[model samples]
Target: MKIPKIIHQIWSGIDGPLPQEFRSLGETWKRDYPDWEYRLWDNKKMVEFVKNEYPEYWFVYQKYPFNVQRWDAIRYLILEKIGGMYVDFDYESLQPMCEILENKTCCFSLEKEVGSNLFKVFNNAMMMSTPNHPFMQKIVKFVFSRTTLIPQYTNKNLTIFNTTGPYALIRLYETLTTEEKEDVYLIPAQFVSPFTGLEAEEVRLGVVNQKLDDCLDNAYAVHYYVSNWVKTNN
Candidate 1:
């Protein structure tokens, strides 16, 4: 049987370094769930989409924007155009993402509390779905729609973006139905990310047992935060 394919998007400029990322992803898949496939999507599509859809917003990307809100919007727009999950280059997939978000229209890491400024702030680092998912479409469109007006208020760079918390909360609130909103799974702050210094133990546990069947066996991916791949045997 052919393994199901999962999509991963990155910038076109990183083509040379893509091999290392592919190797990392491949190793994790082989070690954990060998029956999965990963596909790469680059910045070309996003660039075109941004130009055609929101020409005035093009310069923002040139400034090297780090805001998750805007990045997440681009990711979902691209995902909607093609179909599948979009992951950040810095992320390492310890397991197939589908394992965690199975049958769900869309899923992204979530912060535990409202005031947390941690990584779960923006769903940008990782996002999952098949295609044309209603909620995901709504959230992406809302973010993109606001892009045109962003420059009117602030310059190309804004601190509001470095933390995706407030925007994510608002996006979730806007897109989900009352029940979906209330019952949406946060995927346990640790399962999704270990952004706090206090979460070191949790990351150690994941590193110690980097297998699909171990630590949050139901999780689909592991972010690892670090850009390079390394493993220490326990």
Candidate 2:
């Protein structure tokens, strides 16, 4: 069955913390799929609509010390409450991601096993899942319930709450059966080129042509890792 395409976007603000990496991702949705019904979450009406329509979706404020991690928590809420495909601000798409769903409930990215602190980094940038999915529900629960006390380890580079959300989900994803995992497509490199270190010849080949221009053409979305791009332009 062909999956119905429903695209969504959220802008915190022009000078909001996400910067261009986030807006760039949103721009891709507008540019790549003109037919897509895009929605921004910052407006009061839209925020109310999402909450009223799907109360299961809950968002937390970036209060005091928690300011740094609120964005991640907001994403968790949207994915669970709205229950469709959602992308983070940093994610960029090279093609129509809707074609990949085939109507399946959820999709997400997988970073090759990388460990930082206890939290493993999974591709939370682009996630597709339904509210009814058991696995996804479990993840939403885990994220919401956890208390994110800053870690005491100052020498360490990573923190638990910072990466724990994505890491836990990725770890869980790894354990799924082949058939189970198939329900969630692992969007190949060509489609979701995460701007991680690219020392490998193959990765360079895939993304190196005409570089930014080529990226703009093929990418339905691009996860801009750099914040300056957004701050300077928008």
Best by lDDT: 2
Residue 59, model 2: lDDT of: 43
Which residue pairs in candidate 1 collide?
A: none
Clashing residue pairs in all predictions, respectively, total 0, 16
How well is each residue in 51-110 modelled by candidate 1, as lDDT tens digits? 886576566544434433444556666665556656666555555444556556556675
User: Residue 150: error of model 1 in Å?
Assistant: 2.9
After superposing candidate 2, which stretches have Cα over 4 Å from the reference?
1-4, 14-25, 43-64, 111-121, 150-157, 160-164, 175-179, 194-221, 227-234
- TM for every model, in the order presented, reads 0.59, 0.64
Model 1 residue 70 CA deviation (Å) reads 6.3
Which 10-residue window in model 1 sums to the lowest lDDT? 225-234
Write candidate 2's Cα lDDT for 96-196 as tens digits. 75555666777666443334535335556667666656667666565555344434434212333333345557767777787887676666544565344
